[model samples]
Target: MKFTERLWQDIAPIYNSILKHGFVNELMAGSLPTFLFQYYIQQDALYLADFSRALNLLAARSIRTDDVLQFTQFAQNAILVERALHETYFSIYAIEPATQKMPACFAYTNYLLATTSLQSIAVGAAAVLPCFWIYRQVGKHIYQQALQENPYRTWIDTYAGEAFDVSVNQMLAITDRLAEQAGAAERQQMQDAFRISSQLEWYFWNDAYTQNQWQV
Candidate 1:
């Protein structure tokens, strides 16, 4: 089996939990409270901003020119394409610009940034892969189940769309290629990074659903 396939297997339980999470189920039913959706989109915007930075860090560290170009384009899409979707939601919901990252967003993004900046390129790629892979999975799953008149239709379509699929495929290919060349120790680190990031994906959605805030 390919490394990406193993990564998926490792996180199968978490992905199942995500699919069954109340936020996702309510989203598909189009009955999610607007306030929860609003919180998600706002936190997501903050995430993409930092996500783009992590991609750029990988681009700078990438040894292969093609890998560099791919990471750069990925960063651009995080800023341009995904953020455009967030902006549309902001306008529709009249969500104010988020002033700070919520705890989950802060932790997740910092993990990506630290992994990409300080770790081997292979491990960094693993850290960021869950976001792309899991979002695509959830998006497609929701698209298949989403109500016809769902308020979050645009959000679902964006992640499930052909364009997003192309980028995700590229990332998966990059990760597999990196994994093939990595030493055993590095591959273990990659798996650990991938697992942690996958868990964080679950927390991010749950945090939005709970309207998580800094208690201090």
Candidate 2:
């Protein structure tokens, strides 16, 4: 089996948990409170800013020119398209986006930035892959099971579309190519990075689910 396939299988439990997360379910069922979504959108807008920078670090460290170009564009897309989507909701919700990161939010994005800054690009690339790969999977799954009149239909459709699938496949191909030339230790780092990011993926949503606030 391909490494992506094996990787997915290894993380199936986390993947399944994500699918069953209350935030996902309520969004699909059209039952999620608008206020919760508002908080999520606010936090996500902040998260994407950091995520885009991490992509830049990944692009900078990439050995291959094509990978560099791809990751740069990935960063651009994250900044442009996804943030535009958030803007639309920001207007609707009348939310003022904040720069302050939720604890879970900072932990995940900082992990990516620090890892890419300090480690092998192979491992850094692995760290960022879960966002692209898992979101597409979650999008497709929720699109299938979601309520026809789901309040978050546009979000579901944006993620589930063929365009998103193509991007996911492209990232997977990049990851596989990296893994091909990786040392065993590097490959293990890749897996470790992927796993932690996947776990954080769960917490990212849970933070939104709870609308968690600063403890101070």
Candidate 3:
């Protein structure tokens, strides 16, 4: 079977949990979850922009072809996708994209770019994996709630649909493929980067909640 098919297989448990409880059920039913959702919407755009800029800077430097190509492609796609959704997210907060900046967001973004520029492509790819995986997990969780409520039908349906599955599956497939191609050193770098980025993601969302003055 294709890597994507296998990835979906591997992620089945987490995916199902997200579909069944996290997105839809846990999200809308809990005040904390709603605030968390709003926080992410208000903050992710700036972080994404930082991520994009980092990728572009890496592309400007000398790097090995294969890994760089894969990461670059992913990062570029991320920029375009983020931009596509920015307007909708921004409208929710009555905020414009030009009006936001967080130091941590910049630091994370710069770290990613610097990693891609100075380290192996495997390292860069690993750094980005947490973001993709968490997104899939969160979307699945939120969708479950939306479906349960039958409100926010578009958001619920979008998360519940094949498009989200396809995107998450694609990232996992890439990770699997890269893991096979990477050597021990590269793998270690990737692992460390993944852990760090995952933590950063958590903090990023936490900051959103705090900064937004959201109750709960």
By lDDT, who's the top model here? 1
lDDT of 2 by residue, 113-168 (tens): 89889989888888988989999999998999987788788789889988778888
Clashing pairs in 3: 22-141, 23-141, 23-142, 23-145, 24-141, 24-144, 24-145, 24-146, 25-145
Task: Give the worst 10-residue stretch by lDDT in candidate 1.
Answer: 143-152
* Candidate lDDT values, in order: 0.96, 0.88, 0.59
- Residue 156's lDDT within candidate 1 is 93
User: Between prediction 1 and prediction 2, which has the larger TM-score?
Assistant: 1
- Candidate 3: 10-residue stretch with minimal lDDT: 17-26
lDDT of 1 by residue, 103-201 (tens): 999999999999999999999999999999999999999999888789999999999999999999999999999999999999999999999999999
| Stretches > 4 Å off in candidate 3 | 1-27, 30-39, 54-73, 98-100, 147-160, 212-216
Candidate 3 lDDT over 1-216, as tens digits, reads: 643344345445544544444333544554434455555555677677767665555455525575457456656766776665656645654654444555556567777877767776556666766667766667666665443544344444554567656765665766677668878777666767776776666556546555533244
Better of 1 and 3 by lDDT: 1
Give the higher-TM-score candidate: 1 or 3: 1
- Order the numbered candidates by TM-score, best leading: 1, 2, 3
Residue 108 in candidate 2, Cα distance off native in Å: 0.6
